[model samples]
Target: MNSFTQYIQQLFANEVGGLFAAEPAPLREARQKSMDFFLAHGLPTRKMENWRQCPIDGLVQSDYRMQREADPYRPVEEYFQCQVRNLATQMFPFLNGWFVHPDAPLTKSANGVITGSVAAAVKQCPELILPYLTTTHADKADRGLVALNEALFNDGLFIYIPANVKVEEPLQLVSMINTDDNLLINNHNVIVLGENASLSFVHCDDSIKYGKTLINNVTEVHLAPNAVMHYYKTENKDADSLLVNHLFVRQQENSEWVSNVVTFNAGYIHNAIHLDLDEPFAHANLYGLYLVDKSQVVDNQVFVAHNAPDCSSYQMYKGIADDSARANFNGHIVVRQDSQRTQAYQTNRNMALTDEAVVTTHPFLEIYADDVKCSHGATVGQLNEDAMFYLRSRGIGERTARMLLMYAFANEVTDKVTIDSLRERLANMVERRLSGELTLCDQCRLHTSDGKVLIFDVDPDKI
Candidate 1:
């Protein structure tokens, strides 16, 4: 085995015993099984078909520490202050791999909704979380990183919305890595929505120290019959960090699920999303937007399974790559034999701002049902010269024209966001990123007066 795999195995060996002692028997057994699966598969390499386009060799070779400990010196509000205006939210923060609550580790709402650390929830309400823990995507065979997350994750967010309850305000979960040391953070979250329950959740991942760190995160969500869920994820990390995020969702009959992923900046980010429509009349909408520059790499992989009849799924992703940045999109839709009358659609579009920028897209549809309707397509190109000229001819400056066009392109995805405050914040952030005004200093709330702004000069030869 490689050194990285060996190191991970040793860490598990040293920590699983303590974890077993603290948890119930079923959870402990599940962790052991996950460890075995991870050991069998080891870490993925470029040779693997699913991971060929995104190589993580550098991340694996880096020296990082994996441990669960909270930093008492740092206050939660220092890292994450409320940014969305007029939106009241319950904020849950995770520093490194440990959940840092402002007062306690967990809390409950007036409507009996539970929000807190996953480890604490396991002890307080095992019955509520045990059945759904590590069980959403258990049938997938090639989920090595997911298994690793199951084996090593010590703490993350756990949210439960009881039956017939609706949360008016959104739940905000923020995870930040701010230590000076190189760290390996593995976190897993379990979210359950009971029948007729509804919730809106926003999850953010950021970095303050910008150290060489590796973050592996997994989340499982279960929606009961007639439930509704709205989920949003924002990734804004430094250039020295590597992040891998996995999200899986299972929906019952007549349920509705909507999710949006917005990536502003990162060194390397791989986002994996899976949706299983296990019952009839379920609907899912997945949307994503990414803006990357420099040598950053961003990869988004989405998989949807229509296991029941009369289910619909839609996916749309748009990205922009500048300088030597790279972006990738892979979408797969599967319509099983019993999934008749299933409708699925997927589209990925990208714009490259420089000759060295790279964008790869793959959209696949596998149908075993003859009555299913599915369509998938991808496009990669530069900004339209004709549109640029049209705007310039109308007295708009070249720089302003390019910015307006790019903003409009990205706004198409953000406009789909249902939350007014979140949509406004994202619009501002995307504009700042495209204009080169968003920098690492913004992450730490450290403002400067350098007074430098990037202006996009139209290149005639490239156009």
Candidate 2:
């Protein structure tokens, strides 16, 4: 390991050493094993094929320490309202990587539904928490960051739904990471769904303060036979935030996994999502959208592995870049030897608003089985000028017309945002960014559906 890697290890060893020390015997031992793995691999570099487009040279070159609070605690409610309050479900709140909800209560329903923190579940029912926590996939790559999180994570979320129980309301896990010190923030989460259960969950990650901090978060999900899950995640960290997110999903027979990934913040962001189709008749749909502007950079990598036959998986990602920002998408779809009759599709499309903007896309398909049907494609280009002019012909100004055309272009993907409120919220956020109200992109005036064009006068900071 280089000096920077060694420095990070030493810093973690000295500070925040007692956080994970109280965990159960198995988890505590797993934490140490992950730390040793990091010591051997260090951070990913350009030499690695997966890390080629999203190297961490600048991250390692800068000195970082484990973050700690220097003053009083601030609640995440101060920055964002509970928009999903009417959704009627369990809500878990985290501020600066710590769970602050005092009345955070979870109980089992007679129909077989259990929900609570892993720490709490372990005490009440160890059998419920044993099969899912650190179960099988330990991950051979990216152990450094995983180790970092396992060693430091204190607050986490755990949800369980019993057989035949369906949650009508969406479970919400809201997390806000802010630091008083220049250190990396790590978090771990676990969720389990029983057979024939249905669930929808949303995760929101934002920053409370502007500071140079690294965030590494991991969430493991397990779906039993005939179960269904819909997951939506949005991250809006500060421009100085360095974020790494890992999501793992394991699906049983006839299970479905639908997930959407959206990132509109952070100076440098890296996200990896892995889905394992462990049985036949599994279905998965993955969609992602990222908006990068100024000097910010966001990288997303996804892997879908088919271990059984008669499974289907679909992947689509879109990116919009402005100023000199960068966006990278690296997607891999793997079909095992026994995964015959598997059908998989993957595609990535990116648009650069300025010549200085940079976007790189790499879509790969690995089929070890001879009878599998898999296809993958990638495209990187600018907005279509013809489409912009076509809208302008009907009295729309240049700026307004461009916005309308771009909105329609992105809508092809946004329309698939199955959730009602989230889809509208994301569409408005994209519009605000396009209008330069967020300071993440250049200023632009837009026309409404009724043909009235207006320029936004309010400043993003003021709003």
Q: Which ranges in model 2 have alpha carbons more than 4 Å from their true place?
A: 2-4, 11-17, 60-80, 84-89, 103-112, 122-124, 135-138, 439-463
Q: What 10-residue stretch in candidate 2 is worst by lDDT?
A: 440-449
Q: Which candidate is the best by lDDT?
A: 1
Task: Please give the lDDT score for candidate 2.
Answer: 0.74
lDDT of each: 0.83, 0.74
Model 1 per-residue lDDT at 138? 39
Local accuracy of candidate 2 as per-residue lDDT tens digits, 247-354: 889999999999888776658888889899999999999988887788888999999999999999999898888899989999999999999999999989988989
Reference-based lDDT, residue 92, model 2: 71
Candidate 1 local lDDT, 1-463, one digit each (tens) = 7888888888888887766468888887788888888888876666765677877764665367976567774565543455555557877877778888656677887889888998888888888878866453434555777888888888889999999998888988888776788899988998899999999999888886768888989999899999999999889888988898999999999999999999999788989998999999999999999899999999999999999999999999999999999898989899999999999999999999999999899898999999988998899998989999999999999998999899999998998888897887777777777878776425323111343332222222221
Over 4 Å off, model 1: 73-75, 134-141, 441-463
TM-score of each: 0.93, 0.88
